[model samples]
Target: MLKIQEIREIIKLVDNSSVDEFSYEYEGSKIELKKNKGTAAPAPQMVQAAEEVKQPAQQAVQQAPAQTEAAPVQAEESKPAETTADDANLHKITSPMVGTFYKSSSPDADAYVKAGSKVDESTVVCIVEAMKLFNEIEAEVKGEIVEILVKDGQLVEYGQPLFLVKPE
Candidate 1:
């Protein structure tokens, strides 16, 4: 059995390294970890044990191609002028952990903030539920909410942009 701290250490190593996927097998137990880009949170790691299974073997890790030439061309053509107009001045608040994002405290409660709402460093902008704990995410920046980037009850990953603010 792997300890929580050990798992965390592995996650940290994987996050810093270029490897996209890792797997290990010991005795009859197996574990796999995969990194999902752009989500800002690590995917859930799964561990399973099988009785009378063969000894574990290490699998070759396959690295993805660096980039495709066509992707950049499409991105450049699809970008609108307005996207870059105010983006330079906008502050983005991102998720600090992987969890389900909620716009309100409860199902019937009003949303914490919306477009044009004024906020400060301590303002609770939304809730992120992880391991049955509801974590209140703050603005951490004094600003006016210009846009909400995520939907209520959406699964948000660490570093995923949640809101766009026009800092005061």
Candidate 2:
């Protein structure tokens, strides 16, 4: 995984270059950055694209040890059966990019949402900071926030569930 500092440097270089997209791969990890031209701010957005990179099962097994360090935490994150059943009908608002999750727009501001907060598709529920740029994340689903899956400043992976909402 690329450190936040390294991502920032890449963003700086890409912002200054003529290229609108940049991609890099090392070992099994891949990073792709794209710049949206019409946005008010010219910040590069990091997006994960599906790639067909097949590796030997032996190599995959060898990498398991390095990846399994977070297994315990992941196991702990699993919801109880009852809770899982209750939330089965809920909608998940997921991260579109890998970045540090932020509950509020600024350090002094109140969080955009919390448990029981009602939101519509256009509602900004949180911010995810990538490469020093704060990107406001919309709820996308019409519902009431039932749970927050990530803590403030936590690094989140692409497609990770950030909020669970009880659909309206």
TM-scores, one per candidate: 0.54, 0.56
Point out where model 1 deviates above 4 Å.
1-81
User: Model 2, 48-137: lDDT tens per residue?
Assistant: 232322221112223333233353346235867676777668887766455689999888999999999999988999987766656678
The residue-level lDDT of candidate 1 at 134 comes to 73
| Top lDDT hit | 2
- The number of clashing residue pairs in each candidate reads 2, 0
154 Cα displacement, candidate 1 (Å): 0.6
Alpha-carbon local distance difference test for all models: 0.67, 0.68
Task: Give the 10-residue window scoring lowest on summed lDDT in candidate 1.
Answer: 54-63
- Which regions of candidate 2 are displaced past 4 Å? 1-76
Candidate 2 has an lDDT of 0.68
**Candidate 1 on 79-154: residue-level lDDT in tens?**
4778647767988776655568999999999999999999998899999776666777888789999888777998
Name the best candidate (by TM-score).
2
